[model samples]
Target: MGWLSAGDGYEVALVEGRVAARATAGRAAGRQLKSLPKAVREHPEVDRLRRLAEWLDRHAAACVTQVDTWMVSSLPVPTGLLARVWPDEAWQSALRDLVVVGEDPQEPGFLRDATDGGELRLVNLDGETVRLSPATVTLPHPVLLPDLEDLREFAAELGVTQRVEQIHRATWLRPEGLAEKATEVREFAGGSYDSRFALAARATALGYRVSGGYASCRVRDAGRGVEASVWIGEPYWDGDTETGALSWSDENGRTLRAVEVGPVAWSEGMRMAAALHAGRTVEEGRTA
Candidate 1:
């Protein structure tokens, strides 16, 4: 933000998301000060600038959260909608470099830009710039992408780093013909924590809901919604605890078997479970 009149000779502006001061008329004219002068720090203009910075921070976070939801769910987003928000730096950062599929699922490209007319520019795998104006596009989850390893290799060569995780995200595939009647996965269980609060805290920090002894996250996949849950321990339990089996349930609360879980759901469920497990307290002299 540009400097604004704060007082008789001082001007204030937001520098790198923080309020900074400068002398508009004096020996250090036009020079930014190392610290805010005592007088300028309490000025109304500085307070206003501080509030604006805070709002910008929240706006940026909200943009990232929205884009993350779209990618995680692999939901189809209208080209028009992306074009509307493309000019915004926060939205652009969260979207750029994400893989997008248009009318033809066979062709996927890294998102580069969105035009005023809703056309999208992309960098395809062959190092060619391409344009697409499909009515909608899907940011398929990593597990659903074909030749995922190849995409990772290509992205690395280009130094493409996404603000949100996608191509390089960890994923797991459900084993084929696993017990059709089984409703739980113990692969991430047996993780020990010092207390239930610690285990629950980790889940909460990971953006999973902690309620009634279960840490869970909901995802939409394969045209259906499902919730993946892992037992963390009862609320208010102060004793040491350990993670329990992971499981999936439909919107109607019907537990799904290992074979019944969809690909994205399975991957997301495992991701959540593993993240919670990774925070377990390790014993000394043993690898975490």
Candidate 2:
């Protein structure tokens, strides 16, 4: 594999005529190609690598989109299918470290590895690593995972972030003791979408991550971070979905009291709600 300039201060390496990895120009320049001219910016090989890099990026995105779709729709995915795609770096990156359940949905575990023999390696709730050869596995939504909070903490300690939004999706049950302490910053109504995917698309366009039927964005202010999330329904393509509620949470997945929420977070949450509301479709009988 050799490094080549991919333009815009980025560099990619070609491995067997395929883009293997990419990095900033600083990292790509060294003993391989000390100068930009020697990098052969217009070489056919460099062009091929650039195209391969774009293709790989799209493939990775498609993999993540499909996996997220499966999780939201509660669809079953065959183990053999996963094993087949695991060899592909993009697909593997999207599938790895996600919470998956075997044929029996009740027994969910964290996906660690997929073997060539069509077997899956996972870490169970009891913190045990075991190999499973079920006919199929399902990537359950974060809401369906009982040990989600614990898993999130563990994942944070390991510095593992999933592109599929399993561990990073913040969730919290309304605390009874904090009921009096809690406050509502904004309540939006009449913001509805034709389907969950439509809302997710808008959220994704707005630079938020869709996870567990919600579109969430994280903001850091004055060294403190907060996540603002707006709930959309499950990923049923034809099913109607509407904004449920907007919420803010701390880094540890604890819901923040309205008073505790900063102005930046509040405004951002309202902005997201309004943006989603603007995209709401008017029913046939309703007049705009």
Candidate 3:
């Protein structure tokens, strides 16, 4: 957004509310030394630049979290709000190319750009770009989007990577009679502090992708890959925090028999479950 200078001899440009690019302002700027002398390179100005970069990275991450929350909740966003934030590069990058549904809901389109006058330019399902002035628009869940497959293909052609989760996340309904199902790979009893986000965060830290309100990881053993998933519940941030389930399946999502699960797969699956369980809060007069 602006250029900030360190009193010594360095200046950095803040773009989109983040430190995007930097420039040296004095003699140091012109020096082409393969390596700067320790005295010059280790100056306070250099430290200032390092600190500024770190802060910028954190700010950018927070921006992403806020946008992700909006998409996950499927919140109805006002057209005016979109136009106002669209100018920020961070917001623009996250919003561009996401599938959005207007008031009609059924008629979905891919957002291509945000125009100057609170109008959204989108490519409709019929492969035509049209501008719409809806009162509110929603970034629908992938399951609710009728033309998801087509959108994925189009994205591939355009080499676009969506920052939003919808297109890439897989959705699944709990299988019929899952409670009466044959086998349980693992289960984590929820804790008081173990909100959906906390559990999902744990799963993500373990390199799993969160989808369909579940945190899942894939493991390969004996030449076959199996996915282990833990369901923390829908609207994971809300709802009862005392219950959760874990399951394992093949690539096609077929439930695997306990006997069919490899030793390593079983261990990893249990490890995830136990870790989550350990983080649970034990409340008095509560039973699982």
Candidate 4:
């Protein structure tokens, strides 16, 4: 049994060319990567890891994936790489496993001062004293990077670099909240692309403000890369889609911003839309 449960949050699973399942942690188990796109490499563990990275990278405006765990909040994800997600509580228990349990001005000074056992304080080249934590992170399982040396080799195989970084700080709109906003947006943009409106509306429910009008979502490669145009009210439209340009407008049907939404970025659009809806500044809501 996977982690999905009847009432658990939905996690999208892409197989061959279809929308495989809306899974939870338990339901996610045993779901093969038969449908994931070619951009994701084919090894069993690599496939799952890529999807998880893609999911978090695409859906959460700001998120981090390390070797052992994933963190998607304002808090920094301790540095470490792993093959699976770890339970949050284990962070404290496995402090010694961290790459750096260092102290920062942003962190709670009390917590930093509380730990005196095996803690190391060192000054950097800049002559800044920083207290390092003793925790270390370990991977749940070993992962393969057969193409680690050559960038093109890895990019050719994985369609993207196989590097994953721990997030130090990220802010995002909650997914459930975004679903609710989509409802309001659907009413705002009534047209043939009602589904797009719904999807965007859901994103709005999560707090993303729609800057561009709307465009048709073009699904390709059996659903590996979904493309579309969305309006993000900022200096410019954001999205690195390859399919084509998205068309959106206002009450006057004037073109606001037409952008390409890629399979990986579409998920990010949902998260970005949420941040916009919440009235967060573009710079403040960016993901690392």
Best by lDDT: 1
* Candidate 2 segments exceeding 4 Å error: 1-12, 15-30, 170-186, 190-288
Provide the overall lDDT of each model, using Cα atoms, as 2-decimal numbers: 0.92, 0.71, 0.66, 0.31
**Candidate 4 CA-lDDT value:** 0.31
Model 1 lDDT per residue over 1-288, tens place: 577999888999889889998998879999999999998888999999989999999999898888888998999999999999999888898999999999988788999999999999988889899999989999999999996888899999999999999999999998877886899999999999999999988998888899999999899988899999999988989999999999999999999988889999999999999999899989999988
Ranking by lDDT: 1, 2, 3, 4
Better of 1 and 4 by TM-score: 1
Q: Candidates' TM-scores?
A: 0.97, 0.55, 0.55, 0.20
Error of 2 at 12 (Å): 9.0
RMSD of candidate 4 to true structure, Å:
19.5
Question: For residues 94-210, could you state the per-residue lDDT of candidate 2 as single tens digits?
Answer: 998888888666667778899899999987767789888988777865655667777777776656668787655543333234455765534565477877788888888966788
Candidate 3 structure quality by residue, lDDT tens digits, 39-91: 44555654665677688677666766666545644667898888888887678
Considering lDDT, which of the candidate structures 1 and 3 is the better prediction for this target? 1
Candidate 1: Cα lDDT at 142: 94
